[model samples]
Target: MISMDEFIEFVRGGPLGPIKKWGTKWSLWPVHLVTACCGAELAHAFACGYDGERIGALNYGIARQTNLIIVEGAITRKMAKVLRITWEQMPDPKFVIVMGACGLQGGIFWNGYHMVKPSDVVPVDFFIPGCPPTPEALLRGIRQLQFKIETGEAKTSATFPEVPLEAGRKPRVLPKSPKKISKAPAVIVNAPKEVDWEFGQKLVEEIKAKVEAKSVTITGKNRIAVKVESDYIPRAAMRLREMGFDHVKNVNVIDVPNEDKFIVEYHFSSYSVKELMPVIVNVFADIPRENPRVKSLASMFPSADYMEREMHDFFGVIFEGNPWMGRKFLLAPDAPEFPLRKDFKLEEEVYVR
Candidate 1:
């Protein structure tokens, strides 16, 4: 079997060169690899309103059958591997068109630890610049790629004049550090003032009667904050379950490096009881940051399973009894561990002309 480059050369050198180029140009099938928000623009380009098929290019499903890969937006470090794998699976003579500013040099996520340039991962044929490139811009990129295939020469659709900087005016530089993690940021997780809600007050009283809470306060109209010792979280969760707080809405971990502790909170709500639907109960505790481990409430609230895994991924908090503990759930296998922690700093980016 001839290689992709050999086949391309054969077609170009043969008498049917024009025909082969024409056919290939018109039948560009882009595999679906929507990586971020820019995918919305790509969708708009191919949707009924834009009718991208009018140019003979159609969005295909399988990478094996497609000839083009349209990278929709921000390609993170995790997604770069997927992009490379998908590109390798395609047949020879494959093309790539990257859309969005994120694909070029990281765009808004320039300082993000996870952001990766699409060009660094694949041989790009064209780049459409936009936070989320417009549908028209994406289609234009397709047209440019088609022109390159037929003419055997690459051409940009548009060009702009170079702006000159004033003499002795140095280019602005990004700070070496991107984030300023506070050494001792004041964390007011359950600082309660006052709220005039009879039902909330009654609910707080009822919770105090059942659970051994450190403090129970009505933080808002339908919200109650319950402070508890890390060891008593399971008991608090059990009491809340009995009170009809059927599900866990969110599980969060706030890292306080100065205090050497992690503030873990589980926001619970109810769908079984009508009156409790709007009420959100926050059960929280501070655990030692060095060995942040909490008893998993998954046994009581099945809905907390995924949220627990997410918290475990971000803060490296061990949610004991959760089956996915010590394993990556939401992050890529190669992603940095505990990236969301306050001390994990992103690499500084320097722009070059």
Candidate 2:
């Protein structure tokens, strides 16, 4: 009269319990999911030198075919979705092991705007701590997962020695940074440089004549900087297009909080002209930081569309005429609004004993 579910549970907890554990421990298949730089170590562990497969864990590329997931490195805001989806696709009785210092607690990228903890997205069974852990450390993590599977208890690979502290001694205070942090971001994007490219001199003269720029200076051999007012951004882009800069390589925004301005830069390069291919003309301008708005170059150069959307997501800068503005393009839907702003606060962590 017992149900099938009850019968299965009975078998699992009954005499066949050890058999199930033994089978699961030896055949741990970790799905391939590389979110950051820690992937290199994972590869090193499985490669010919280390041969991690000898221990029964194999790295599978497809999610449905695996029961274990090894999340490698920093999971950014956008990457959280992928991690969740992959975890969901796997069959039940699955396990997760997050490796690297970034996955554990953000490591060097502590308090970063886009960093996401892997445990936030899935049920992590174990964590392998290291900036980029040695291949041996990764293999040991696999063994820990296996031990957990066989015995229903997770074990630490290493234990630290307890150091005795001096009695009644005051804690030493470290000195603060000698340099004062600037209220505004200090970025030297357009420092003037001297170079000996004969073609660059002619090109500078041509750009000055065509584009209405505050100053047209050749920053380097293959670099030219054109500073313009916010209102003249679209016009300057159009004039540059007429010359030979057919595409926008990148669209960047610098948030200067103290100055109350945002510097919008468009790096333009050419595919149509052979001579202009090596030249990168940076057309940049300043706009009010409070409510920054710049004309979209998407219509003129389609590549600027995605970068423009990314800038809006980061700094809340409005790219006027861009169809995809004011939407979460590069970050997760629940990510903090305008996270790249100087005043944006990160979630604080609490340590409990």
- Give the C-alpha lDDT of model 2: 0.89
RMSD of 2: 2.7
Report the Cα lDDT for residue 195, model 2.
Answer: 84
List, residue by residue over 182-227, the lDDT tens digit for candidate 1.
Answer: 5576897777868788888889989999999999988778988999
Question: What lDDT would each prediction earn against the true structure?
Answer: 0.90, 0.89
Give the runs in model 1 whose Cα sits over 4 Å from its true position. Answer: 1-12, 43-54, 60-65, 160-184, 351-353
Put down candidate 2 lDDT per residue, 112-215, tens digits, no spaces. Answer: 98888999999999999988988999999889988998888888979899999899989776654454555654766678887889999999999999998899
* TM-score, predicted candidate 1 vs. hidden true structure: 0.85
